[model samples]
Target chain A: MEPLLSILIGVLVAGAVYLMLARSLMRFLFGLILLSNAANLAIFVSGRMTAGAPPLVPDGMDVPPEVVANALPQALVLTAIVIGFGLFAFALILAVRAFRSLGTLNTDDMRVAEPKEKG
Target chain B: MSWYLSLPLILPFATAIICYLLRDRPSGAWVSVAGSALGLVAAIVLMALVLQNGVVAGQMGEWPAPFGITLVADLLSAVMVLITAITALAVAIYALSDVDARHGQLGYHALFQILIAGVTGAFLTGDLFNLYVWFEVMLIASFGLLVLHGGKEQIDGGVKYVALNLISTILFLTGIGLLYGQTGTLNFADLAVKVDAVENKALLTVIAMLFMVAFSVKAAAFPLFFWLPAAYHTPSFAVSAVFAGLLTKVGVYALMRTFTLVFDHDVGYTHTILLWVACFTMVTGVLGAAAQSDFRKILSFHIISQIGYMILGLAIYTPLAIVGAVFYLVHHIIVKANLFLIAGISQRLTGGSDVFKIGGLYKSSPFLAVLFLIPAFSLAGFPPLSGFWAKYIIVKASLDESLWIVAFIALAVGLMTIYSMTKIWAEAFWKDHPDGIDPKLSALPGRTALLVPVIGLALLTMVIGLMPEPFVTFAERSAAQLLDPTEYITTVLGPEAMQAADPLEVAP
Candidate 1:
């Protein structure tokens, strides 16, 4: 389980990094999505490859039993997933707007927005 | 009374809902101002409340920390929010007549309020991932506002801004993910308790770098700051004012919070990187400012340069340095916003912010000149003004750290900053214009100018610089908050880490 999780994280990292280096804004968005997924997986796997832990204290005790699939990671991952979705949506919309206006999704095409008065 | 914890989040969200419902109606402009004014008042009251009560926090949706979202308000958060609210209010009033009519001022107002709400949210949120959410909320609204009057330049600028920010968000998300994976917690307080419990410090170092990259991008630090100068001047003065005032500081604040609290001493590699980056950022930003011919553009570059100060303080990692950074952030926010306002007014008179094109402004409008001079000298770190105290604290802190090289760099930066301010003065106020050029009222805005608040902000800057004991005390307490995250973690997780963090708390 640990080895399989590591492989998945590696693949996720590769795909996200590749997307990140792309020239197009859409690709950039995809890159971000890929990166976030990779992170979420890393977070998930970092909890030691748990098969199942509902995160609730078993038998509803005050101090959660030491053996619950580490509810903390799951909670963190949940928050991360929601935030990732928001970021993805925002980026997606921004990409659409840029393409619509700039007539190209290529990052290389976007330039000259600086203070022209400054050299 | 404890529920006032939610007002900062609730108010702007309510305003956002109203904004979407109203769309582009001019009345929406009125709504935005009313909402921000209320927020400003709430924020001030909150500040007063904190002053009286020390710190106040409450869990959201009635969930205890560790299991639910939390909002914590201490001196640091309150001060940042107060500055943000005041700037938002000033800009809201400024937008009425000064803005483009096509958006009816309301559309811009809507985004402006959301941006404020998001910034306030970022500062107040006790959870790390929730901070990411507020950042996105801000990014989307800022994107909308940046293009509210999309000309060729604005479209171009917005593209870069949106692109880089999206990348940063991804980086931030990934960092959160990695952090959660390693510690099995996302709540900052919860994570604080457990992250240090990790057996492998190297993996923790990697996670820390991830968060640093994310925040640095937002803060406009050296390599990551490339997007800022290129895009800052694209929007109108009122828009630029709030953007300049509150946005980047959110990143700086996050850096201060995360490094001091969550990462603690696990930031070895990152600290070296930050120190070098801070110096380079200052030098390059000042150079960028020196080379600029436009007023706003110069200020924009200086934003990067001055950000180095905040980063430098944090990198050095001292209590006094932290105080300096806090002081610098407040001073820079007020001065930067007002400088943008002055640029807007200058253009209103001259149709340009370019020094070469517009001249003899000293004779045209003495009030404008006076307005420009306050922030100008203040920014240049002139004595007896708010800007001086900020620079003094930072330089002194660096010297005490026995960081002679850094202290020298800071002094050089100060001199360079003065040179840039004087250049603007010479070009706009001292030089002569063409024979046929007629100087006019620069459209003295209106009831919307809200001159009282502008004066209040300026006076506040002065008071902060002069009678600064309260602010310094607050800043020190705030800085200490980072040293002892037991309160923060406990505040969020509801004593989950209280007994556990006892030893950790005592050591700091």
Candidate 2:
């Protein structure tokens, strides 16, 4: 199950990278989202995948039973999810503002701002 | 009330809520001012305890290590928090009216307080993943501050800054994930105990590179520093003042922590890379500064160069070098922030920080001139300023490491720093003003609120420079504590839980 999840996340990451290489600004943004999620899934899967079992300790447990799926990765993933949300929000705002200000969301049209500034 | 380790983290949070709820009231300014002063007191107490106790740590929720969030105040961390608190307090007072004028009173104070909270959090957090979260918090607040006025250049420059930082964040998070999977814990002390026991040296190497790359981007080291110069000079004086002071040093401090505590064995490979990179980073950054005609632009480039000195010490991995890195970081944080405030004052003097257009600032603002001159000399490593001691320590450490090439590189960077300082002085203070003065911009008084902090920092620079014994002794003691992880880990966790297995047993 761990190997299977790894392979699936690997393919998702590869797809994300490929999308990131595309020309449109929106496609690039999508690429970032996909790549981050793939990474999150990898983090979730790497702690030895146990399908359908939530990570909690029983009442009689001395410590978290080894049988419990790890909670650390889940906490890390939750943090990542919120941070990813922040990144996506900030990126979307930038994209929308870029569209409004530059009159295009295509990367190709964003080239003219750096031409030698007239003194 | 005695929880100095926690107050830097708490006050700003409470103030943020206060600033948010109290909408547009001048009371927010007073709240910010009071909170920062109180935070400063907390930081000083933390500093005292750190100096006395070596490393002071408390686990939140009264849980043990690796199970709860721990806040550790060591010498280096405490000094950083001290400098951060000082700058934040100064910038808070300085920004009061300016913030009101910008009508971003609520958001400004909120973000400003949050930025300090994040810096303080970064300084004190003993967990690697928590550091990333704090970095993000600071970055988000900085992004808001940078683009708040909604200018086109800010929007444009901010996009690049955001893009680059997001990539670095991913890299940092990815490294933390890799580290957690391997070691099963995120606490620094626990990681220190278990890192050598981790199965694969190669895996650790990869993760170390990921961390190095992430911190380099934040610290604005060499190739990764392109975004900093692209955006830093474009922000308002208040925003620039804070970022210039606190942002990159957070990265430098993290680099020191992670390298020593998590990846000490990989120093050989990293040393080789950081040496060449530090040399180039210092040289190229200074040259970039030399190329720039603007006041703040040159200083922004110098920031990248100064960061190289800090990295140079870490890369060398000697006790002296590490101590030097700590000293250099504190010195640079104070002087750099103070310089930005000087630029802020200059803008009021002649209506701009652009050296090409503005001049003869000395005539109008003699006090500002004196203020700028002190930090400038300190930055240039002139005798009797904290800057000189910082450089002296790094140079001394480089010599101790027997790296003549690195020592030479450091000396040459020092000279270039002087050149940059003189350029700002000559252009902004000495040269004649072309526009005479812009009536509207020059009409506004350069407020005393701003000058007071700059003066405080200037006095500190002089005091530290003239008498380097206490700081160096403290830094050395701090470095000694860091080099011996047993002292730190034992203090944080009870000695029994983290006692390493007998080395003799491992040898067989």
Off by over 4 Å in 2: A21-24, A60-66, A104-119, B438-446, B501-508
Docking class of 2: acceptable
Docking class of 1: acceptable
Compared with the true structure, what per-residue lDDT tens digits does model 2 show for residues B1-508? 1266788899889988887666577687778888899889888888888777678888877777878888887787899999998998888888864565444553788888898999999999989888988998899988888877666767766776877788788778878877877777788988888787777889889889989999999989988998888888877887888898899889888988888777887777977787777778888898999988878889999999988888888887788877888888888888888898878877766777678889877776666778888988888788888888888888988888688888898888889888988888888887778888632323556466767788888888888888899888877887887777777787676687466732211100
DockQ of 2: 0.36
> Per-residue lDDT for A1-119 in model 1, tens only?
76787798789778878987989777777776776777777766666654554657657678666545656566667876786676567567666767777788887767657523435
Write the residue-wise lDDT of candidate 1 on B446-494 in tens digits.
6236354456667777787778777777778877776666666655566
- As for candidate 2, its interface RMSD to one decimal place is 5.1
Off by over 4 Å in 1: A52-93, A115-119, B267-269, B442-453, B486-498, B501-508
lDDT against the true structure, per candidate, is: 0.78, 0.81
Best by lDDT: 2
